[model samples]
Target: MFTAVFNSFESGMIYAIMALGVYLTFRILDFPDLTVEGSFVTGASVAAIMIVNGYSPIIATLAALGAGFLAGILTGLLHTKGKVNPLLSGILVMIALYSINLRIMGTSNIPLLSQKTLLTNIQDAWAKTGIDDVLNGLLTAIGLGDSLPKTWSILLMMLVITVLIQVGMSVFLKTEIGLAIRATGDNEAMVKSFSAHTGNMKVLGLAISNALVAFSGALIAQYNGFSDIGMGIGMIVIGLASVIIGEAIFGAKTIVRATLAVIGGSLIYHFVVTLALRVDFLQTGDVKLITALIVIGALLLPLITEGRKVKARKKKRLMELQFDHKSLEEGK
Candidate 1:
């Protein structure tokens, strides 16, 4: 159970990065960018290919980030220059990326089981620096000696990355251009009235969004030791789930709080999925269905709660009216 939970946490943190990217386009820019599905695979494909070709893992990951940025740029151009609808522009880029990813990888899958990935290198350094021994001792002192997770080093690394990205995002959103992006989402006409190029803001917002998403993909490919072409299937839904779940649980009243909530939501989502898969009758293939149900539940929770509140108010009002009528009748 401990190992399972730990694994879930790691996966959650990685996917949280992608969720942050999704938040930018969906929540901030109000852009229905389906390019995420394709950009994610593009990141994995680029990183996997570069790693297989004996490039440094760091270089491969950076290359993947660049590739993802380009994919976002294409989608942006299609929407802004080609006069395509935002939704259709994303769809077109997504379709094109499927072929582009295939060409980059030269196959449908690439395995890095024996290759040196970023996580593997981190593990090696951890062992060399005696950090594992220190961690083991700390766990023993805490009566968790037997529960010491083997993935602790990797988990720590991911935690650091997640925190850095969150901080970066919080800071970025407060910048002048970031304010423009938010304004563009809230009211494009108002932003245009202020002399801001709404089109440029949309394109830049998407570029940043997809870049973060691809970065997540690169990390996931390395962490899992493989990158499959279909790995990005249903990614947009997952991202939305994370964002909605975070906002619902954390209350997005502020940017910093919202970003933290998104990360927390991702962790909760992974934990729920992990526990569900532990059921005896559940199969691995049911993950997508489970995700869909989770999203539905998250999306409907607020409405359900609000409905109950409304009913309670109405009941109270009715009782008060009845009491007033009784008082009038008694007086008469």
Candidate 2:
């Protein structure tokens, strides 16, 4: 159970980055950007291709981000500049990126079984050098040998990365341009009232959102040791699931709280999915069904809450009407 939990968390942290990008679109910008599937693959393909060509892993990852940004910008342009419907624009870009991704791989898949990735390199260094082992032995002489595992390394990395993203997003949303972007989502006319360039804000927001997504994709491909074309399927659903689950569970009343909720919700979602897969009753064949159900639940939760409120209002109005009729009868 401990190992399973650890592995789930590790995987969840990677997916959480993708969830953050989704939150930006669905939660903050309230845009249904289905380009995630293609942008994700685009990032993964860029990273994998660059790494195969002997480029530094970090640079390759950045290149993937750039690719995602460009894809997002194209989507935004289609919607805003070309007057395409927002959702249709995303679908168009997503379809285009599929071919682009295939072209990047020059094939359908690029397995990283023998390739050196960021994780493998780090693990290799730790094993090749006896620094940690030696330190563990020294610490064991006292009382800290049990605490010597580098378990904190992955956790620390996730924390640092998540914090940076959250802080950066928060700061960005506060800037004049960022505020305008946010306003564009809330009220396009209000944005125009401020004389803000709505098109520019939309483009910027979409680009940044997908850039983060691409970065996550690159990281995931490196960590998972392969960049499969099919890996990005249902990514938008998963991201929407994360954002919905986060807001449902934690309530996105504040920016920081909402960001944290999305991360937490992603990990929780992965944990639940893993558990469901392991359950004998659910079985592996039910994975897709389970995912679909989870997504449906997330989507309906807000609506369910709103329905309850509506019912309560209706009841109150009915009681008020009854009271008015009774008083009028008495007066008559």
Candidate 3:
């Protein structure tokens, strides 16, 4: 059980990066970019093929990020410069990437079990540098050493990496360019009135968003030991689920809080899914159904509470009116 939870935590950290990317487009930029599914596969494909060709894992991962960035730029240009509908533009790019990713990979899947990945090398370094010993000692003291096994190294590394990305996102979104992107999402017409090039902002925002997503994909492909063409399917829905769950549980009133919320949401989603799959009757194929139910609950919970509040307020007002009428009759 502890191992299951730890694995979920590690997986959640990686997915949190993708969630942050979705939050940028969905919540920050107000762009319904379907390029996520394709860009995700693009990242995995590019990274896997490069790694298989003996390229450095870091280089392969960065290349994937660049590829995803270009994908976003295409979607943005198609929508802003080519006079295409935003949704249609994303669909076109997404469809195009289906072929592009296949061409890059030269096959439907690429296994990285024999290839060296950033995480694998980093794990080796942890052992060489005695970091593993120190962490093992700490874990043993906490009685989790049995269930956790060698996962401490990975958990620690992912924690630092995810926190760094979260901090970096918080910093970036507060910059001048980031503000422009936020304003564009909030009111495109108002931003245009201020003489800002909203087109450029959208392109830049999407480029960054997909870059983060691809980065996550590259990591996931490495961690899971294989990158499959079908792995990216339904990724957009998962990302949206993370954002919705996070924002609902931890109000996104500020940049830091919002990013933190995204991370928390990702963790919660993974944990829930992990536990649900352990049920005797539940099958692995039920993940999408679970995600759908989670999204529905997150979206409706606020509305349900607001409706109850309205009813209570109405009742209170009626009671006060009745008391006032009784006092008037008594005075008469």
Candidates in order have lDDT scores of: 0.91, 0.84, 0.90
**Which order, best to worst by TM-score?**
1, 3, 2
Give per-residue CA lDDT, model 2, range 278-323, as digits (tens).
7778777786788788878877887989899899999999999999
Instruction: Please write out the lDDT profile of model 1 over residues 195-310, one tens digit for every residue.
Output: 99988898898998999899999999999999999999999998999999998778799999999988988998999999999998999999999999999898988788879989
Model 2: how far residue 279 lies from native, Å: 0.4
Taking all chains together, each candidate's TM-score versus the true structure is 0.91, 0.84, 0.90
The better-scoring model by TM-score among 2 and 3 is 3
Q: Which residue window of length 10 is worst by lDDT in model 3? A: 146-155
**How many angstroms is residue 185 displaced in model 1 relative to the true structure, after the best TM-score fit?**
0.8
| Model 1 accuracy (lDDT, Cα) | 0.91
- Stretches of model 1 off by over 4 angstroms after superposition: 137-147, 307-332
Per-residue lDDT tens digits for candidate 3, residues 28-92, read: 99998889999998999999999999999999999999999999999999998998987888889
Selected candidate, larger lDDT, 1 vs 2:
1
**Quick one: how many clashes does candidate 3 have?**
0
